[model samples]
Target: MRNDRTIKWLILLIPTLTIGLWEYIRHAFLLPYLSMELGNLLAPFIVLAVTLTLVRSLFARLEQSQQALQREKGTNAALEERERLARELHDGISQSLFLLAVKLDVLDEMKIDGPVKELATGLRETVRVMHEDVRQAIANLRLPPSPAAAAWVVPLRELLGETAEMSEAQADFSWSIPDVSLSDKEKVELHACLREALINVRKHANATKVLVVGEADGFGGFRCAVEDDGKGFSGDPLQSPGRFGLRMVRDRATAMGWNFLAERRGDWTIVELRKQGGAAS
Candidate 1:
């Protein structure tokens, strides 16, 4: 409405100014000019052109603003939907799969053999993978407003002791930080990597001993190492065809902006990770 009023005022002013100038020129020079009928006919066309240009410009600006607002609303809606799906997967599907895996494991232990036992074990492993995938999805959906860091002293002695019992191997775990705090995200990623490393050791490492170590470096970073007496590989990691486990470790490390190294030295293979900044402690 304001734009329309301004255009109307401009259109009226232009004809008024033109007529005043024509009259001044006619009186001062004593010259004949076009008849008033011709001037009257051109005035309406001039006013129409001016009004159309102004209205077109105003509408263009309005259209641009509307488009920008719509784009912003669409982006916000996508983020909210992603968050909602992540929450549901974490709270509902993950718990259900975990419980199902537990039940299958119990059934497998009751002298089951052949296809049924194999199927049960496979189902349990499948559920475990799904659970991990859901957790990773949730982690990826998180936004940049990070949670506050807190310190917790992970009881390395107790934790490692339990892990050793479960692995049924001679566990040689060491740590320098008796008390250290890590961000929740970092802690989750680190734990997942550790679990994968241990599983690899148990499944492929044909040795009687495994060593796990965690330490804080002086340069505001942390390092972890998992070494096993396994049959080490000789080829390049990227060129290897049956190295999915190593690929997963490398991918997780890359996602967290950490450095990962896996190499063989004689009969032992070592997987080392270095996180570049202090997480919480």
Candidate 2:
């Protein structure tokens, strides 16, 4: 509405200003014999030009404002969803998982058959893993979609450390992140892909040690690698059954415009992800 009023005023003033300027030039600067014909002929064209310029400027500003509003709307929606997810995980899954783990621990203490006791122990271990996963989910939800590298580094290392301990494997984590910006989607996919890789190690790789490395490209990109000393794939991991998790990771990397590679180098199985178009720091 404001823009419309400004445009309307501009349109009304264009002719008035053009006519006045013409009359001033004709009467104040010219001889008495000067013809008003030229002034009359050019005044409308001058008015039209001025009107077009003003209209274009107004529309440009309007378009810019519209774009800014849309961006703000998107940001708000994303934040609201993040908060909702955080609350649900904390109040629902996290609490339930914690209670379940406690119950399993109590079951383990009961006097039962050897096999039943073993089963209870196993169940408790599984519950512990599930509880950790729930806690990680809650953490992710609590953090902003695009958080500082430092904010994620400690949590990621702890997650890997826990997974290694569960699998009875040694874990080494190295991170050298430069101050580069990553979009929320990119960060989420990156973390998911790395988690999947580590999961593969924990499930299949009879490895004793795992190495995880991460580094930012310093120009708005980053890379991650998870390497394990395990019995590597013979041919193609992607073609094997029960490898759907890695396939999902590959798809996510592709969607995010990141390079993904999983292969065996000698005795080590390596999975790597690098953001496209990002130069090394």
Candidate 3:
């Protein structure tokens, strides 16, 4: 309504000012010629020029204002999305995980058969995965992109150590992440890839050790390798339903625009990732 009023005023002023200017010009300069018909003809061109200039200026300002408004709208939308995801994580998955934890604690106290215990353990792990997914979603929504120099080695090492201690199988783990930090996106993607690899080892590997190596690329990117000493598959991972872990890693790498490879080496399975460019700081 305010804009409409301003436009209306501008429209009214254009003709008023044009007529006033023409009368002044006629009295001031064209009075020597003293021809009313000549002033009438020139009057229209003056009014046209003035009107065009004012309209152009008004449109330019309106375009700038619109662009600014659009940018603000986008920012608000992003913030609202973050808040919604956070609320979902707290209300839904957090409560579910807490309930699962209580059930697992109860199972630990019960005198159950080996098969029943194993099934309980599997259910617990599934619930844990759901918890991790919710936490990741919340982090992605709430946290700003990590700086390029953010170090991921310490956290990765700690996570690997904790996983090894928690798993029942005899396992050995090694890593060589550089002393530098990774961006938030890189950290998230790398964690997802590593988690999938570890899950595969726990479920299907039937062997002992996992090795991880990471290094910084000269072009501000990074490369990582995850190798497991297990009974390796003989078929193409892309075509095998049993090779879901490899497919998941590949999909994650592809989504992040990174290079991914999974192949069997002798009796071992190797998965590699190469990020092409630095993520946002």
Query: Which candidate leads the pack in lDDT?
Result: 2
Model 3 deviation from the true structure expressed as Cα RMSD, one decimal place: 8.3
Scored against the true structure, residue 41 in model 1 reaches a CA lDDT of 74
lDDT of each residue in 74-180, candidate 3, tens digit only = 77886888888798888887887988889898997899978999988888877776677567567656864333454444445545554455454344444444534
Question: Going through the candidates in order, what is the number of backbone clashes in each?
Answer: 0, 0, 3
Q: Largest TM-score belongs to which candidate?
A: 2
Which of candidates 1 and 3 reaches a greater TM-score? 3
Angstrom error at residue 57, model 2? 3.7
Q: How many backbone clashes does candidate 3 have?
A: 3
- Tell me the RMSD of model 1 versus the true structure: 13.5
Q: Per-model C-alpha lDDT, please?
A: 0.67, 0.77, 0.72
Q: Ten-residue segment with the worst summed lDDT in candidate 3?
A: 145-154
Judge candidate 2 at residue 101 and give its lDDT.
78
Q: After superposition, how far is residue 164 of candidate 3 from its true place, in Å?
A: 14
Cα lDDT of candidate 3 equals 0.72
Ranking by lDDT: 2, 3, 1
True-structure Cα RMSD, model 2: 6.0
